[model samples]
Target: MKYLALWFFIIGVVLIVFIQFITSQNVKRLTEGNKRLLAEVAIQNRLRLLQNDVLTVESDIRGVVITDDRTHLSNVNDKIESIRREVSALRTDLRGEHAETYITELDTQVGRKIVFSQAILNAYDSKGKEAGEAVINTGRGKVLRDSIVQAVHQLDSIRQYRLNGIISNIENNGARARFMGVGLAIIACLACVLAFLYVVNKGRQQERMIQMLNESEKRIKEGAFIKEQFLANMSHEIRTPMNAILGFTNLLRRSSLTQQQQQYVDYIYSSSQNLLTLINDILDLSKIEAGMMHIEQTPFSLNGLVSSVQVMFADKAQQKGLQLTINVDPSTHDTLSGDPVRLTQVLINLLSNAIKFTERGFVHFEVRCLSQTDDEVVLQFRIKDSGVGIAPEKRKAIFERFQQAEAETTRKFGGTGLGLAIVKQLVDLQGGTIHVESEVGKGSEFIVRLPFRPIQNHTEAFAAPAEAVLNPVRGMRILVAEDNQMNQQLIRHLMRQWQMDHVMVSTGREAVEALRREPFTAVLMDIQMPEMDGYDATQAIRGELRSDVPIIAMTAHAMTGEKERCLSFGMNDYISKPLKEAELYAILQAYFRTADAQPAPAVVNLQYLRELSLGDTEFENAIVRQFIVQVPEELGLLQEAVQAGNKGQIKSIAHGMKSSVAYLGLTERLSPFLHRMEVEAVSGTDENHFQEDYEEVRRVCEQAVIEARALLSTSA
Candidate 1:
């Protein structure tokens, strides 16, 4: 290491010295070039001026002869004085090999040209116009002017040639300097790297010994990291598709199918759900181990939680020839403040294990109040089951990951042994503790004691079923930013099924662009994408675009703290991947609760109608009534035309619809979709986006009709 440092220091010094040499060379070259350039430019400017002055004086002499205008002779002497000054300046500035010869000739020719011009002007004034004209026609003055110009140009050429030579030399010098500097710098870097590698190789023996000594400790630390990575990877890779599977399965089950097909689909759905549960258990255990699990303090109903858990496991328990029962003390607070999700997870894991192990006896779940206060309660959960019991010495081990009561229990019972471990972890995360009591021949009772706050303010602590809760007052134009094709399709199906309007974009950047171009009630942003991720998109929409269009993160990550992380990134809410249609709709519903009662921002721009009416109220009323009556019928005919491939009717109806929407000032929104229909009528290409666009058109026009009808009613 010391040798490597010394070598690096030497290389650094060399690099610095090389840079200094190159920079000094560049400075010297540039200074010389600049000084020469100024001198050359100055000389050239003087020559140009000297030539121009002589020409101007000659022009004045000719003007005094031709028009007899004395004003032309006004500046001739001042011009002569300027000419003399320019010749003097050029004499001082020029420094070429023939500088003296060129300047002497230029001075002489300039003097002769001025003398000729004065003679002509004097002839024009004293000897009359014919004498001056004759002198000019003699061509002597022309010869003098030509000689002056030739001398000035000769001097300019000399300066230009010298300047070009100097510039070429400077460039060549700079090129060489740069080439050498780059070569030396690259060599220095190479030497430094090689030396470091050599020294490290020499020191490897000691490093290897030290590494061997701490290998176990390193692995002990790495085990936790590996588990963390595994948990995160599973959350994204497994749970994302799992969210889609469960969501689409829900949709599939709703459709008509044969009995056998429905049964097969049910089996697939059950297996997918079970796989999802296992993935969640593993993630939960990892989160608890990493201290990433967070317990919420929201008010929830204890009875409702228990009832839901019972319903979840009742069928399984019955199929196993075991009864599932739940009992909550009547004195227990109806609204207890704790994490219902985490608590439900705990209850579900315990009950699942109870049912999994029990074959003959009932698996009894009881929630009892251990104690109570003004704002807090201690609840006791007893999950007792007549299952294969744990040995006295192994009860604690069963709570550890992947540990079963006996090694043979896994093979015999067909389980991962993660259920109990997850249950204990969940309880412990919520400031709770778990204990077990059992004998091998009898059963096991797992008791959990948890502290929760009682809510003084009564709240409706349970959500209704997804189907019952989804009552959207009006379809909101939502923008969905999702990358997964299947997930996108799933969300699309859900949106279409609910009769809500949505636009799908594949990336965050597209979502932001779309939002910027139009108005949407909410944004469903995906976390991972190609152009931009959800977090950055939300930030762009909030910090850059300054749009507070309720951004909900559609992430594949369902790990602990994900929701809070999303919230911190300016996301209003988050839905895990393989989206549950109900959860997605509910979150969207919350954001648009007020918007449902309101009309769209672009609903019906009345300015177009008002302009056409020109203060004629009756005309406006007639138009509005015609719109309310004719638009819906036209929209229906358009749909039928599209479905029936009536190209002529499609174009005719779309053109008419375009005019109708244009009259209502919806051209920017509705015109594009109607235009697409016209194109599709002609081309008839594309999967089905035109249909979705038609749906959007229909939705907007419905709102327009409602508002238009109200306008007429109020006017009447």
Candidate 2:
């Protein structure tokens, strides 16, 4: 290898020397040729200028003679001076050339021409038009100008001949240089080929090593990609069951239970919530590492955001027996355009860390407008905790992934050490800066500065009332396509609680089939399912079924783009797994309350009956008895439709009797089933299985009629 390298270097040096010699020779010749050509061009240009100047003087002299204008005399005098300067310039430029001889002769002729022109101008000035005309008629000025013009032409011709010679020489020199360069290039290329052979033999070992390194790098990248995919899948898998646990726990908390059981449930809820937080931290870290995390800028309320964060940590702070303080500057605008979600995420991570590390002392959070301009607002957030502070050396590493103040800190605190890491990444994504200051055994303070654009003509965001009265529209039926048994049960239980009529399906295929068979007010779709996924199902519902039914994506995948992916596939909105009761209720309220469909009036309009009766008890009783008799037959028909798998008939009967059911004040309980029957009838799916709900509706309706009859009797 050493011998080959030595040989390659020797050949390379020789090749370079040969090529450089040839290139230098060509460059020198081209440079000399360019200089001579420029000189010839300059001489020829001067001769042309002198000729034009003399012609102008002659024309001006004639103009003075003919027009007898003093202005013409001034023009002639000016041109003569210009001719003199041009002649002097030509004399200087053509000093050693053949044009030098003609330049002197040309200079003399130009002087004589100027003398005659001035004589004509003087004639016009001192004598008059007659004398000037007499001088011009004599033809002395014309003769001198003609002589100068001829001399100028001779000079130009001589320069042209010189230029032609220079160009011919340049062409000859270039051709010779090119021929010589070609010969040298051939020799250089031969030497290069031999050098290349020597280098190739030596470089084989290095190339093999480089190839191995590249393969190693590729494997590392693939491993990282696989790890990210595994984490994403694990996130979905874990969130699925976690959702069920938390969702069921929320349901259980609302039910009647013993004090001990309730306490146990609370513990379970808190532990589950913590587990969810840990999972989220891992997923966020994975995304940030994979470069998949993005910051979204949307309009949000600053006051609301801060208050919500305060509320979130308030419980934990109380449990830890530490005071938590949140102070917001009044000067901060309530509405600003920014990624409030990411901002909130970063703040929560910082606050949680602060609260967790601090056991005895208080944790203080403060937000103030550091600066405000017409378009942007810079907010300064400081989270100071009077807990165990970090040592000076460890402060910098705390924000790194999977790092804490020290290894012991992670063991003592029982955290993933990813909070600050995520916090730092999120702040950077938002074009913000975050820093921490700490002294061991005292405390730590984390400060973040973020800039956000101010929202123009922004309306303050209002939180829904805690106990929002949900007057669910009558006959509002929704379709839920959930594959998980627990999730399906959770949704069913919630739907019943809200008195919302809905049908449950196990797959996207079923959801699509159901939609085609019947009309639903909305569809709650789970993303991952058998037979078909939620995205394809939504597309089918939108295209094949041409149904504009709002499809809310219930997904466990909490990746950054999950919501947009669902929305792109025609989902109206989305809610992540382990859905919160408030979010579900809010979604329902937003969908149903805003629907143009009005609520069916309460059971039995007493006012209508009173007006019809005209204070007659017998007429009201007869009316109640007739309604009772007709309802039994309609109920039997509904049962028959369910038995025969006649969805159309069942829907027709449900819609026909909905008014009477409303009149009996049974719409709240019976209306849900009636709405369900109406929706299922259109779906034409598993009609026989729907009898259970139909039977329940029957029982409620019968009991309602009985209660109504007693009311009628008493009122009469």
Q: Which candidate number would show the highest TM-score if scored against the true structure?
A: 2
Q: Write the per-residue lDDT of candidate 2 for residues 614-692, one digit (tens) a residue.
A: 6866655654654554466567667766776656556667765664454334545566777887787777665344688
The C-alpha RMSD of each candidate to the native structure, in angstroms, is 31.4, 22.2
The whole-model lDDT of each prediction reads 0.75, 0.76
Off by over 4 Å in 1: 1-230, 373-376, 455-472, 593-716
lDDT (C-alpha) at residue 272 in model 2? 96
Per-residue CA lDDT of model 1 for 183-209, tens digit only, reads: 877777777777777677768966987
Question: What TM-score does model 2 achieve against the real structure?
Answer: 0.54
Least accurate 10 contiguous residues by lDDT in model 2: 458-467
Q: What is the lDDT of candidate 1?
A: 0.75
lDDT of residue 454 for candidate 1: 75
Model 2's alpha-carbon lDDT is 0.76
